[model samples]
Target: MNPTELLSLLALKKAPLVGDILAKKLIREFGSASAVFEQDKPSIAALEGMGDKKASFIENKTFLFKKAEKELEFIEKHRIKYRVYYNDDYSKRLQYCPDGPIIYFEKGKIELDNPYVLSIVGTRQITTNAAAFLEKFISEIAPLNPIIVSGYAYGVDILAHKLAIENKLQTVAVLAHGLNQTYPRNHEAYNEQMMENGGFISDFWHSDSFDRKNFLGRNRIIAGLSEATVVIESASKGGSLVTADLASDYNREVFAVPGRVNDKYSIGCNELIKQAKAHMLTKTEDIAYILGWEKKQDIAIQKQLFVELNDEEKQVFKYLKKADKELLDIIAMDLQMPVHKVASMLMGMELKGVVKPLPGKLFTLA
Candidate 1:
């Protein structure tokens, strides 16, 4: 590893001493870390927050450059690439955050381009309606060629990626851990797919473990990198709302897709819309109108807005739009179309970008 790379590893791998707060103070006083490491015990003892015992211990602590050799070897063996905060390729958005990660690791290619990037965030416990609605949302915007970014968690984040993948759109996942590892083991498949299709990014250097503080900071980056944030569904207080609040503070558009007023999971989203902190999106047209994307999508399609037809399709659309429920019985009773015929019609609607069929025979309108 180069001297800078070696320095970064040494800095992060060391046990937390000074909270990030004290470390900044210490860094400014010492100038370069090398100069700090070279200081005599007595001189270190004179520094602020450095009582005789702490100064003597930390000043003399073995911060030998070789201590990072093993970590360097491990990452090299796995072919991982890393970067420092000042490096050109570092995430431009994250770099602006206060005390952003000192370094980062990358698993795939990504772009910091465009005047527009939007985050798709929500709760991990998602409903079929939420999933299907997100699918249509992505489809409408795919033609406009905007970048989609999200945290690589379950629920809304996964739905965003799944829809982005199906439409062959560019996406990225901002994680809270080192790129060398993932927090949720179950997202292994999703991670691989993202690396191949978009990218997985993080502020932690290799060997860094997941930390609660790290995730809160991670939300800041998600909010910073995008032009706006959309919360599909969230609890009263959770990571999604944190990102939305940050987006609002950053002077970016914040949109929310409201659910049934009584839904506990969607209460936060409803509140955001109600409080006028977020724009309510009944269709992708809401976002499109905000971005002036009519010039981008098919003019005819864009100009018409997303119309909810009031025919037989409307009856079916209304039912699915409300939520995804098993339809074999409902179709037979409500639509009065034969079960087989209704099934065929539903499939047609799915192809037409009007609905989505979830696992286990459930369906929702997209």
Candidate 2:
């Protein structure tokens, strides 16, 4: 987009009583952001949903344009990049969502062309087991070269972003604030490296400050930009669950990791599964299977199988490897290990993508 048109879009964003939905309506009616600005008051009011007050706001463009000019200066000085909703560079998945941002500012080289995009979200207070699962999950999916999207906050969100980087997969951080600064100040450490492969995206301008309510808007981008949203962990009420709901609203698949019934953080995910709102995700391959994503190449399953395992895990791994499928109790009794111990080992191996649990307590090598 040219400078004039970009400025007009910015001004349109700043206009009072005109949000993404209304702005989109105006853009469609006038053909372009610039054309919307050129229309007379009567022309603006004549359009559906436009009243005298909104028409006056569109007519009085000096204040909004001034603000847009300042934003333009910041964009130019910082070398920030932006994608207009109607442009080819915009996110294809997001384009289908009518309420997606009309324009969003970005910094760094974010490759949106990747066919497999998954948004990972969860509770801010992550558990050790959840962290381990994410590590193994990222490792398993790394072979698909999927683009990972997250809110860039602490816990599951940041963990997802960090793991994506570690695995050399492109990751996008959808921020609740503007590009001027990272929220939670301490996370600034990951900014440089994130921009190296993925980048930060935000609909807010440099002038916008961090706000609690901004998360609802941010979550939509997290949901709309991906083919699926994965919730590693979440409490009964939190932003991650909100993203899952939004993803469902967008008709995208939502998956949640199951946790023990009484676990506090697992309530949301378990509820999702019980309510039929999300698929019960146990392993990385479940994602590929449900989404019909063929493995692009071997995902190092053999390498993971050989990974250092405790004596008990080794015994169970050996037993499961030789058999097509075995009952959990049979393995425990045959190996002379406690049923609980075998169950625990199976869970660990499942996270490692070395074992998969089938119905009726059956276990098999993944």
Top candidate by TM-score:
2
Tens-digit lDDT track of model 2 for 44-158: 8888888888888765788889999999999999999998999999999999998899999999889898899999999999999999999988867775678999998999999
lDDT of 1 by residue, 1-366 (tens): 456545644553352444333444455677645555666767766878765765544543455344556566766787766755556876676556545555555667576675457899999998889888888788666645567888888888877877887666678888887777776778887776787677877755566688877777678778877777999999888999999998887777899989888897789999999899999988887887886667555644442236443366656764553444665567657767777877877777666676678786778655
Q: What are the lDDT scores of the predictions, listed in order?
A: 0.71, 0.89
Superposition error at 310 for model 2 (Å) = 14
Model 1 whole-model lDDT (C-alpha atoms): 0.71
Model 1: CA > 4 A from native: 9-67, 210-214, 291-366
For every model shown, what is its TM-score relative to the native structure?
0.68, 0.80
Off by over 4 Å in 2: 295-366
Clash totals for all candidate models? 0, 0
- lDDT value, residue 56 of candidate 2: 87
